[model samples]
Target chain A: MPCQILPPYLLEKIAACERPEMAHAATAARRSLVHDAPLRRLGDRSLATDQPSPVPRIADPAMPVESGPAPTVDRTVSDAEGSENLPGKIVRTEGGPVTADSAVTEAYDGLGDTWRLYWEAYGRNSVDGRGLPLDATVHYGQDYDNAFWNGRRMVFGDGDGQLFNRFTISPSVVGHELTHGVTQYTANLVYQGQSGALNESVSDVFGALVEQFARGQRANEASWLIGEGLFTAQVHGVALRSMKAPGTAYDDPVLGKDPQPADMAGFVTTDSDAGGVHLNSGIPNHAFYLAASTLGGYAWEAAGQIWYDTLTGGLAATSDFAAFAQATARAAEARFGGSSAEHAAVLGAWKTVGVLPG
Target chain B: MKVYVSRVGGVAGIRLTWQVRVDDQPDADSWWRLLEDLPWQSAPSGPVQPDRFCYEIKAEPHEAVIAENELDGPWRELVDRVQRADTDSR
Candidate 1:
């Protein structure tokens, strides 16, 4: 056997740091990359989940591809039945008739809509840019109040009736979860510090685009709010977070104020939530909103396309906000011309957010 | 005795916390038992999945950042009880 300097677990601890520039951490990440399927996942994954996660579905080339006029959207929905188990029982699949349970129908349609947004706008087939089947589980745990993409698939919770409703109620939330999977297959930005925030912002950007596309709304016409209908009437909030104006999404005695910062001046620094990935994401969220709204038409046409290109083109696992800003600027210039308003708008948005110089 | 739980992460990325004053409860011993059952010597450490809920639990130096799926038995009971307490997460 090859000499083992440190235990595999110790190597994992170093790999979890995921800072590619750090020689020790990078070597550890590279070593851990082949330790096991699950450990390799953490090499570029957003979450350092304790439990073993389900393996991502790889497209089987051995299985023949079905060519047709329209690409098939394969979605599978499951019912957890108030348990924490994922994909508990398959309740619905592609082309299945709507179920009596609203959660089931909503999840199915939401998954389809998210898949359609990626396909229709970017010509991306699915989360992996391959025909990876989409899977989602609903009614997970009793009165569970959050939704998530657990590396392999989406899991939805029925919100506590006191403060929130079913998670499937919002299209943006669904879009957001699915985009995490997209990020996993693309840039796979390390889910810590500024890079984690960029990973989050990328999801929010496409999440908003998915909602806007579904509604056929112009960039300026869109709500620009994520989780718009997730809150109960009792909660004093319009949405979970806002792209147009961050920190102003909600204010209530129960949930407190929205903690997002719209610009670098207000950027929050912390160790929680993977270095405040969700909190600092507001900075880029607002930037995309500004660029899309300034363009005055469908966001997917220019602003969204630029962001999409930047994401798919990939970045270092440790790309910070400034690096992401420069990449988007280059993408905009390449697609829309260096002198075009699209390029100018992208640069101006980043400058306004303090990610780039004015 | 205060048992604190703050759930962060998920797609929403908001932090919601619950601080239970176990001393205030008549069944303080029961609460203590649950708190003691948790792994306090070292926080459960590992890589978390994207968009999964991460909980920060603290009863003073006894703190851990646990992913939602890892929560079981006492951890689950404490969180569920704290949540059902219906106190606002300030």
Candidate 2:
């Protein structure tokens, strides 16, 4: 699946609006849907052929592997220049001077930050854990309302000024999309039904953690919001999805209420959105927030580590919420001892979210 | 006659539906001609790609659901026209 930061349900609400003032939003939503459809099809064909690995392996000859000591952070940011074409003009390369375009600079920096969090916190090199050079394309399409990682690289949209700002405006959004690459390389989670929801939840967890790590904030101090500043002042919302409080992220007249359900009780059962990957993700998202906050201190230290281990530790592609919950509990037990608070917290979190028995 | 074109499948899994009355459109005859000859019952059978789209096109009496890539010739033209017309109207 093409990992889009903005959920489709939100766009559907915007598209369905009858208000005269919402015409711009409606048009943008429809355009975004039309634009993203083929990209998803492209992603499917790519994944079917290529089996990615953590260890460095020659996949594409065009992207030559760097010799000598492994490069820590090799990033390339491109400018789409308001067209749909990806990896457009190479505006900035690794260790190069900052670009005048804030989106370009932000994409460059956000890639580094995500890399730092993964490498520093979990000892993973990059998205593929083998120092895979991060590449991003910003300013994609005219008034495009979404951002996504299309298997190989990150693509950001210049949002319709009516609702969203530049997608790269939020570092966690960058982290979130990049983490989709991480999920792709590791779990290879089937982006459908429960497994897909788990895939989205895992990205949200790391997205929030990457921000927390960058700001040097403990779990208690972190905002726990994904795409926090992506919304414009005109929109009545703090962020796209709230880890701390899922369904309460946004409730605007034009955008409608946030449809996320924070527990299994409210789990959305539908064939849409790959079985509500973004919607039902709130259940596992809330569980992660609970685990991290309950464990206290730097979330990356224990909570993040546990989740990281669960992700990279041979997680099945088709694993569901219960399976993921059990894996995290196991990871916590393994990392911090069976009797440790981290293990108890992990188990308690799943129980609280109704993913596990109380 | 009214034509309802809905696109489903994508990472978000949300469906987009656009309804257009044939008489209201400038290309009404073109739409009617295209729909008349379309293989309404012959949908491509296979697993849907992770985030790819499949379209369900209903033009009153006839309906067809075709895969994103499977769309061809007049069917593609009709879908494109309806989507463009909807966006233009908005």
Candidate 3:
């Protein structure tokens, strides 16, 4: 704060000023330098940064340099013009005024919320943890039915509007796609079989967390819905998947029924969807819900930290449901102690979801 | 010959399948050419990205799995044509 009042140049001059009347000014300048020093060094990565960057957080005079990142929120939202072609036109950028296009504004704000959850809750810089700029494309296709992470950027479709609404309508869905980028950088889980399900589950876990963090909802108050508000009124569903009750999110004649399995017993064994990545993920999703809700506070605080640790704790890319359960268990113990309630909650949650031994 | 395309592994986790009886269509020659012109040599292989659709195509004797992200010009056209033909026949 003081850095803005006294420019670094002015502070330097004042620190060097030997006038007896300016002794306090020199002392204050030295303190500001220490307080404003960047806690984490940002690396040089050649990212597409055509938009305006965040207002630089100058070193404040009265604050200590905490262990959080310097907080870079570089976002770019483009439009596909109803075509499959990517990033058709730049419609919005970081810190820019809201656009008339609802999809573009929703995406920009959603990306910002996702970035905030990772940065504030876990102190992560971006998807790559290196302050990688986030880019998204909306209106990806005419009557398209899905959204996805293309290994580089998030792409959202204008849903057919018969069964689904626009993909950017729900913040959780945007968070879900962006978390795919997170999983790509962290565990890089093999996108097939149980490991693939874990990949999906991890995304859903943090996706819900992003929404919760933004809404300031406690664990109990949260919806635990992954794609809420994406379905139209005609679709008889509250969301695409419910962590609390996996297969109960939707059931409609046209859209069929939600096929997710809550625990291992009902887990669908199929060759579709990369060995049912979307189906089997309900197991871990429920596990996270139980752990977070059981702790009964901010879901992102204790439960989220454990999951974040396990994600970056270097599990194998081929980690299965059981291996992932073990990793989360160990992560909870490492942070909250084996005797602590947090570790117990994680183990209990996984056990309830049939991913761990009872 | 018959062609079947199934799209799977998207954010919604739903499978959508479309098929066409290549010989039954009035545009049979174009369908045949599109089916045969697939770039079989350059299949997608690398670290798999999350949530992108994986399309599985099954023809009379040939089958291929293509990632949506890697779906090139030919892949997109084949899918679009089959979807259109399937819708018309339905």
Candidate with the greatest DockQ versus the true structure: 1
Query: Which model is ahead, 2 or 3, in terms of lDDT?
Result: 3
Candidate 2 similarity to native, TM-score: 0.76
- As a whole number from 0 to 100, the lDDT of residue A54 in candidate 3 is 27
Q: What share of the true interface contacts does candidate 3 keep?
A: 0.79
What's the true lDDT of residue A357 in model 1? Answer: 86
Per-prediction backbone clash count: 6, 2, 2
lDDT for each candidate structure: 0.80, 0.77, 0.80
Off by over 4 Å in 2: A1-70, B1-18, B33-84, B87-90
Ranking by DockQ: 1, 3, 2
> Model 3, B1-90: lDDT tens per residue?
789998777788877788888888887988888778887667564433577778888886777788877777888888888888887776
- Comparison by lDDT, 1 against 2, better one: 1
Candidate 3 residue lDDT tens string, A175-214: 8888888888888888889999998988898989889877
lDDT of 1 by residue, A1-358 (tens): 1234666667667655545355445333333333232333345344656734433323222222454555679999999999988779999988888889999988998998898778756667888877789999999988888888888888999998978899999999999999999888888989899989988888888888889877767787999999999999999999989999999999998788999999999999888999999999999999999999888776866788788878877567799999999988887765555666988999999999888988
Q: Higher-TM-score candidate among 2 and 3?
A: 3
Alpha carbon lDDT at A34, candidate 1: 30
**lDDT (Cα) of model 2:** 0.77
RMSD of each: 15.9, 15.4, 12.1
